[model samples]
Target: MPNNKDLPVSPFSPLTIGPLTLRNRFIKSATNEGSAPGGVPSKRLVQFHESMAAGGTGMTTLAYCAVSPDGRTLPNQIVLDRDTQPHLRVLTDAVHRQGAAASAQITHGGCFTFLKPQQAPRPLSSSSGFNKVGLMSGMLRKQAMSEADIQQIADDFVRGARLAREAGFDAVELHMGHGYLLSQFVSPLYNKRRDQYGGNLENRLRFPSLVLRRVLDAVGKDLAVVCKYSITEGARGGHTAEDGAAIAQILEREGAHLLVLSAGMNVESITTMFGSSFPKENRVSSNNPIMAAAMFIQSLTAPKVDFRELYLLEHARKVRAAVKMPLAYLGGAKSLQSIEQVLGEGFDAVTMGRVLIAEPDYVNKLEAGTSRDSICTSCNRCVAMMYTPGGTSCVLGQPGDAQLNAQPAALI
Candidate 1:
C-alpha cells in the first residue's frame, strides 16, 4: 500500500495528476463568480481567473460551468456547450499565459437552478421534488428526471469534459457535491425514487458513477479528472462521512485522477460548504422573508462554529484513509503553517477559495515568506457579493462597490 509519508513534503513541491503536473500544491477551489453573462465568459470572468493565475495558484478553477442550459445555478453561469468553446479557450489561455494550469468545475444545478421561466420551462432533479434553492432564489418548481434525462445528463458531462480539454484546460473538476444534480441523487434527503437509481447507497451512487464514467471515457488520458464530493450532507437521512468514504472509493475505482473532499448540501447545510454566517439583522433586507427566517433559524439551531484553520480537515482525513487517490484538502486553509500542517498530514495538496479571493498572490507570498496569514478574517463579504450581479470583490479593499449592496459587515 502507498504511504502518506511517501507523498511530496513541501507545499511548493511539484505534483502530478494524470498527464498534468502542477507547479505547486495550492489549488484555487471553485467559487462561483457571477461574471459569466448569458452563460458566456465576460471580461470580469477572464480577469478574475487571470489575476489568480498571476498570483500563483498551481491551478485556478473557473467556477460553475453547467453542462446543459437547465443545469445552471445562476442564470449567467458559464455553460459547457459548442458556443462556449472559444470563450473557454480564451479563459484557459489567459491562465496558461500566467504560468498556471486551469481547471473548470462542471456541474448541473438540478433543483437548485436559479433561471427564469423564459430561460427554461422548469428545473430538473433526480426525482420529482420541490426546488429548495428556488424557494430562496424566487422560482419554485422542478420536474423529476426521466431515465432519458439521466442518460442525457451523463452525455452532457462527457461533452463538457471534451469542451474543457479542447479549451486547453489542464484539468476538469466534476462538482458532485453541494446538493447539485449529482449530489441530489447521492443524498437520500433529495433523491426519493423507487427505481434502481435510488434507495440504498449503491443505488444512490449509480447516476453519479455513470456520470464519472462518461467523463473519464471522454477525456481520461488527455486531461486530469478531479471530483469534488461532499463528505457529509449534515442533515438527518442525508449522507454521512462513511458514505463519503465509500463514494470516494467508488470515484477512485472509476478512475478519478484526484478527489477533492468537500462537505454539506445547499439546502441542508449551506453554511458548512461556505463558512459564511446569516445574522438575524441581515435578514431584514432579504427578498424572501420566509427563506431568510428559515436560514436564520437553521443558523441558530445548527452547530455553531467559529471559522478556524483547516475546518474540514478531520472529516477529510476519514475520506483520505478510504481512498488511495491523491486527495486535495479544501476549506479554511489560511496561513503557510496551516498549509504545511495539512501537507504534513499526507494530504496531496491544499485548495483555497476565500484566501485567494482576499490575497490573490497568497502562494507567491508564502514562497517569499512575506506573510504567514491571509488578510481575510472569514468575513464572508466576498461570498455575499458573489450572489449578487456585481461579481466577487473584497469588501474592505473595494468599498462602494455597487455590486455588493450596503449590507452590514460579516461577523468574524
Candidate 2:
C-alpha cells in the first residue's frame, strides 16, 4: 500500500488562504451528508469536521449552506439565515480546535430545490427553468429575477458571509458554480436575460461581482473570500473552462483571495459527484449493483463528453493557464500521487468529496504514506436523494450503526 515511508513527500509547505495559514494544501471539499438540519450545525457536523481536521486537513469548507430558503435542493441543507448562527458556532469551534481553517460555502439552489420551497423563487433563466436533478422530485418553478430581487439576493450573500464570520469561520466561498443560483445566472444554458445582469460577458457577470463587493464590504479585507466557479459544466450549452477563467478573473478583481475550480453541474443523473460515470465493478456504496450496468454502458460511449466529477485532469490544466489567482480544484480525485501531480501542475490546492467522506483521515493517511482503498464505492448513494428522510447521512460512509458513531454530524 502507498505510505509516506516510500513515497516522495511533496514538501508540506505553508499555504496562505486569505489571512489563514494552512499546514498543507489538502482541503476537505465540502460534502453534504445532511449533518446540519434546519440550516444549523448539529453536534454530528461538529464531529465530522473535527475528525477531518484531526486527520490533518489544511483547511475545510462547510458545504451546501444556502443563502436563501427557496434555493435549497434538500430540506436538510444548512440554511444561513438569522436562526443558523447558534448551531454553526459549535462546528466552527471544532474545526479551529483541530488546527484547520474553516470556510463556509454559501449556495443558492435556484429552481432545483426540492428540499424546501424558498420564500422567494427568483430564477435567473425563466426560459429554461430550474434544472431537474437526480433522485429529486417535483419540478422547480421558473420565475424571472427582477432587478429588485437580484439586489436582495446579492445582499443576502453579504448577510450570510457576515454570519459565517460571526460563527468564527476563517473564510467564505461563494457557490457560483455547479448550476446553482449564481451558476444559473452565469451559465449560457440557464441565463437568458437582456438586462444589465445578462447579455455580454460584463453583463452576465454583473450580479456575481456585485455580490462579492457586498460581501467584501460586510466582511472586509481581513476576511478571505473564495469563489468556486465551474470550469466546464458537465452538460453542454453551459459555460466552458474559458468562461470559468473569466469568472475567476472577475472574482480576483473584486478582491477574492482564491478561486475553486469545479466542473459538471447537474450531471449526477448519469455520473456520480466524483465524476465517475461508471465504476469498474459493483462495490458496496457505489451506484447500486443492479443499476450500475446502465452507467457503465453510458461511460464507454460518452465519458469525456458528459459530466463526471471524476479526476479533473482534463479541465484543471486549461483553467490553470487562464487566470492568475490561487486556484483550488474539486472533482473526484482519489489518488494521492494524482493529487500531488495536480498541485505540481499548477492547481494551488485539491479537494475531494466522497473520497474524504469514505475516509475522513485521507489527508493524514497520505501524509503518513498509507495506501488504503477508500470504503466508498462511487455509488453516489448519498446524493441519489437530496437528504435521507431526516437530515443527511451517507450509508456507505457511515455504514451500519457502527459507522453512525463516526458520523455524528448527521444528527441534525
Candidate 3:
C-alpha cells in the first residue's frame, strides 16, 4: 500500500485543471443544495460556496446548472444562458475569494426535466420517454430533438462554456453523468431510433460529442474543461463499465480536460438513484452490512452476483483500468483511506458530494492528518433533498439534527 504521507511530494501537491491550478487534489464534488433560485444564485448560495472554499477544496463544482430553460430539473437550478451571466459572476467571485476554482456543470434535462410544456419547455432527446423508472407526470414529458434543435442545444453548450469563462469561473464541467439528458442520449436503452443521432453507439454518441467539439472551440484552450460521466447507469438494460470506458475515451479524444465518473440516475426516484436491485451485497457504504444480511436472507429469490459495492475503492479501480484520463472517482467516496487507495490505484483525484454537505472542512482535516473522523453519515438524507417538494435543503442541518451533518461516521 502507498502511504499518502510517504510520497516524495505532498498529497496536497499542486495540479492544474485547465486555466486554473488547484493547490490540492481534493475537490468538493458537485452536490447541489438547490441554493440558486430561478436560475440566479442567491446570497445563501454565495455563502455556501464560500464556506466550501474556506474549507480547503482546491476546486468545487456547481452541480447541474441548466443550459437552457427547457433543460431545468427544477426552478432552483442555476441558469447559464446569455441572460444569466451576471448572476454567475457572484458565484465565481465567491469561489475565488478563498483561492478555489469555481467549476459550473452545464446540463440539459431533456426527458428527465420537470419543466412544463405549456411554458414552452422543449425537452430534447435522441429517443423519447423517461428511463425504465416510469414517469413523474410532467417531469418525464418526452420531446424528440430535431436536427435543428440539436444544433441549437449544442450551440447553447458552447455558449454556456463561454459565459462561464466570462463570469470568471475557473473551470466549466459538462454534466454527462447520472440519468440526465446527455446520458440519455448516450445510452442504448434510451436511444432507439435509426436516425443519424440514434441506434448504434456511434449515433448514440453523436450529440454529446458534437456538443463537446463546439464547447471546446468556444472555450478555446484557455478555460479548463471537465466532464462528469456516469460509469454505471443503474437502470435495467442500461450502460455497463465497458460501455462507460468507451465513452470516456471518446470524450478524452474530443478535448475533455478531465473525467469525473459516477453512477446512479437522478435523485428524483429512490430506485434509480439508490440502485435498489444491484444485489444488496454489491453496494459498498454504510448500507452494505445491512444489505449484505438482507441479501443472504433473500438469496433464494435474488440471482447470484458479485459483492463489489458501488461507491467504494473497488469500483474506482475497475474504472481506472479502463480509462487513461485522470479519474475523479465519485459515489460513496468519503474516507481518507478510500481517497489514498484511489490515488495509489492510479486515479488522479477523488470527488465528494454529500460528504461536504455534512463536513465542509473534510479536505482540510484529511490534509492535517487529523481527519479520520469525517462527518458524512451516508444516510443519504441529502440525496432526498434533490427532489423533496419545495426544494432541497439540508434537513440534517435543521433542528434535532442541527449538528447531524457535522457528526462523524464510525469506520467499520
Candidate 4:
C-alpha cells in the first residue's frame, strides 16, 4: 500500500556517521561467510565480500570475528591476531575498491561453541548451566566465566577493535545478540549468578557495559562503533521489548555510534531469524536424532508467526523512540517497498541478509530501476552452509554464481 514517493528520504542517499560517510542506506547484514579457516581470511572470503561491495551495499560487515580463541563459535572463525592482520587488510582494500565501507562484527560465541573437545578445551558462558541448544546438538561441557575471565574478554574486545582499525575497517560492530557471551549475561534465561555480573538489570548489563566502554576508549574517535543487540529474547523469563529499549539507551549513553536492532535467542526465538519457516534439516544436526526429535517437539509448542515485510520494525521502533542515536533496521527487508517504509519511519538505514545472499546486486538493480524486489524467497538454505566445510551460497543458485553459489542455504 506504500510507495517510494510516500517516503521523505531515499535509501540510496549518502549518510554520515562520526567521521565516516557511507554512500547509501543499504548495509549488507553480517551473515557468516564460512570461508575463513584457521582464523585466517582466505581468497574465497576476500572474493565473496568484494562481490557484495561491488553489488552496491553502503557497507559490508565481515561476520563473527572472534575477540579471542576461546570465544569463537567454531575453530575456523576469524580471530583478531597478528598473523591475520595482513589478510584483513587485503579484504578491506578490496571492499574499498568497490566503493563500500568495511565493518567487522566482533563477538564471543559463549556456550554455543559446538566443537570437539580437541578443538576447544571448554565453552564459556555468563554462568555454569546446561545449554539446551548446545547440549541437544552435542556440546558436552561449558563453564562459568570467572571475574578475571570476564575482564579479560572485555579487554580482548578493545584489542579486537584496535586490530580492526589497523586493518583499515571503517567500523566495528559489537555482537551482543543471538545468545553470544554478552547477550548471555543480559538474559535471565542464562544468568542466574548472585554476583555483581548477574541479578537485576544493572547487574546483568555490567559486563556488556564494560566491554562497550573499553572498546569506545580504544577506538571511539578512530572508527565508528556499532552494536547489534537483541531487543527481546522472545521467551518467558527472558528480556521483553521494554528491556531491549532500556538496553538501547545504555548503549547510546555509552557512546555507541549506531545501533543495529535484532532479536531472538537460539532456543525459543530461533524462528525469529528466519521468517515464515525454519529449515529444520539445516538446524538440527543430522547425526543426532535426539536433537532432531527435541527440535520437532519444541516447534510444535512454539509461537506461530508469519514472515512478512519489515517484521522487526515494531520492536526496533521501541528502541528508536527510547534513544536518539542512529539506528539500522534489520530483519525481513526483502523489497524496495519495505526499505522505503523503514526510512520513512525515520530509521537511519536498512540491513538485509537472505535477500542479499540471493541477489548481491539488489541495491544496484533498485537504483537502476531494473527491479523492486529480491527473488530470495526466504528459504534460508544459505544458512546451512555455514556449518558445512563449503562456504555460504544460495541453494537455488548455480555454482560459481558470483560469490554465493546459487544453491539455497540456511540462516540463524
Number of the predicted model whose lDDT against the real structure is largest: 4
Off by over 4 Å in 1: 1-8, 116-121, 137-141, 279-304, 387-390, 399-412
**What C-alpha lDDT does candidate 2 achieve relative to the native structure?**
0.68
How many angstroms is residue 364 displaced in model 4 relative to the true structure, after the best TM-score fit?
0.7
**Model 4, runs deviating above 4 Å:** 1-7, 116-121, 136-141, 280-305, 400-412
Better of 1 and 2 by lDDT: 1
What's the TM for model 1? 0.89
Error (Å) of candidate 3 at residue 247 is 1.1
Model 3 misplaced stretches (Cα beyond 4 Å) = 1-10, 118-122, 129-134, 139-141, 267-312, 386-412
Report the error of model 2 at residue 225, Å: 0.9
> How much is 80 displaced in model 2, in angstroms?
1.3
Backbone clashes in model 4 = 23
Lowest-sum lDDT 10-residue window in model 4: 403-412
lDDT of 2 at 224: 78
Cα-based lDDT at residue 18, candidate 2: 72
Give the better candidate number (1 or 4) by lDDT.
Answer: 4
Cα-based lDDT at residue 97, candidate 1: 95
Over 59-116, each residue of candidate 3 has an lDDT whose tens digit, in order, gives: 8888877777777766667668656676667767878889888888888877665556
TM-score of each: 0.89, 0.82, 0.81, 0.89
